[model samples]
Target: MTGGGAAGLVGLVLVSHSAAVAGSVAELARDLAGAGRLAPVEPAGGTRDGGLGTSAELIAAAAGRANRGAGVAILADLGSAVLTVRALLAEEDALPPLARLVDAPLLEGAVAATLAASTGADLDAVTAAAEEARHYRTS
Candidate 1:
């Protein structure tokens, strides 16, 4: 685990309806950010039964695991996934204060968040980066 401070790298959690989607997104984000730069990028997708659905328990667990004592930023692929993450946060009292859900496009947001976190960016900065990715255009 890494040290916790203003300069500590923030962790990332990717939530999707499909486990494969979450895992693939994490891998892409890590590749885009360069290897060994990002902290724990855990994927919390699918339900306990391996079906296509989001699980609040899984999200909460992933958040806990992803936090390296610094903080965590969560990005979701769908509204339900976001809702699940939010519900988990609201229901879990032990969740870290720095952990937050970033309302941004999932793939772009994860990529941006991962890159920012890789640079030792603080939680707020990483969340901001993820949100900023929402405005990214490729025209």
Candidate 2:
């Protein structure tokens, strides 16, 4: 686990309706970041029954695993997934101390967040990088 401090590397949690999607994005982001020794990057996707939906349990568990005492940035795919995270945030002590739900495109945001975290960026900077990825032109 990375040390907790102003310069500590933030952790990332990727949430999606489909388990495959979240897992794939996490893997891709890790590969893109090129930081083999980076902090935790977890994927929270699908329901406990293996159906397509958001799982609060999974999200909370993933956040716990990802949090390296530095903080955690969460990016969700679609509306319901975002709402699930929001509900979790509304509950006291549902997630890690600094867990935040970032509003950004899922794939791009995960990659951007991972890249920033890999550089030992703080939680705020990691979330900012993910949010800023929304403005990036793909053309």
Report lDDT (CA) for all predictions: 0.83, 0.89
- Candidate 2, residues 33-104, lDDT tens digits: the string is 874557568999999999999999999999988987788999999999999999999999999999999999
User: Each prediction's Cα RMSD?
Assistant: 3.0, 2.8
Clashing residue pairs for model 2: none
Candidate 2 ranges with C-alpha deviation above 4 Å = 1-7
Cα error of candidate 1 at position 138, Å: 6.9
Best by lDDT: 2
TM per candidate comes to 0.88, 0.92
lDDT of 1 by residue, 59-102 (tens): 88888788776788999998888777777677647456678888
